[model samples]
Target: MDALHPHGMPKSAAETEARRLIADWAQQPDQQPVRHFPTAYRDTTPLPAYGTTPPVPQPDHRIVPAWAAGIAVASIGVGAGVTGIGCGAWLVLQGLASVTLTSVLLVTAPFAGLAMVTTAVAGAVGRIRAAVTTHVYEGPVTHHTEITNTSHQQGWFTRTRNDIS
Candidate 1:
């Protein structure tokens, strides 16, 4: 008797009961097998002809006419031109009211002459200084060198070699 069979049923009797249950299950009728056909059938009805119905009319979507748009653009361009001319006239009047040509020339002529003289003197000094000083090298010079490395790897092993010139 096993612990699972608490009613003290013998092992052989339990085995015989299992075998009977299995035989009873196997004796049941089998489900019918599904069958498949080779050829497929389609509907034989005729389809309606295309382009037989009238086309739907589309609505107009333009908010403004072409002539009206052209007029608006022309008006904007003329207004901008008038505004530019007015601003130019105002700036000229303001400049004339603030300073005169003769006064500007009298105030700036001396400074302009002084600046020209100083520039000439500075240029002459720079040329003399550059001519007096010079650089000379007396050591060996070497060109740039490039190094290349080659590597070979196989399984768990790796080897590398470098060449420089």
Candidate 2:
């Protein structure tokens, strides 16, 4: 294989030279790029002297309420299981009563089952939501949020360079 071509295939030398020149030109920095202005309008003002140091959010690390999430998950699982088993039992009872006893009271099984299941699901969802909401700061580690002013001044043909700022 020659330098002009690879894999025993031939390409136009002029095209290859043009591609190389274009790549070199692309790598060069822009000559007349937009410049930053010293007195240009700014998007954000500097923090006030009193509030220059932002308040650091401190996490509650005295105790971890990890059990809340666990208990909530367990409760949700138990609720689902109970709902399933209760509904299945009610269905079975309804089927048995329909075949053997043929009583009008058998129709109430579905309603009872539905109510029980709805209650269980609601309780589970409530517990899960509580766990997620109230279970914050569940570790010994503290978290912090940092706010930085990154807004820069901009203008046409401004003398200020970004590197100096």
Find the candidate with the highest lDDT and give its number.
1
lDDT of 2 by residue, 1-165 (tens): 435466444557756777998898788858565788788544465566774565556898786479987898999999999999999999998887756443545767889899999999999999999888755466587555554444545675434323321
TM-scores, all models, native as reference: 0.30, 0.26
Per-candidate count of clashing residue pairs (backbone under 3 Å): 0, 0
User: Using TM-score as the measure, which candidate wins?
Assistant: 1
Tens digit per residue, CA lDDT, model 1, 1-165 = 343455577777788898998897788759444688798666565655875554446898979989999999999999999999999999988987889789889989999999999999999999999999998988998875888999999999999998886
lDDT of 2 at 60: 81
The number of residue pairs in model 1 that clash at the backbone is 0
Candidate 1 at residue 151, lDDT? 99
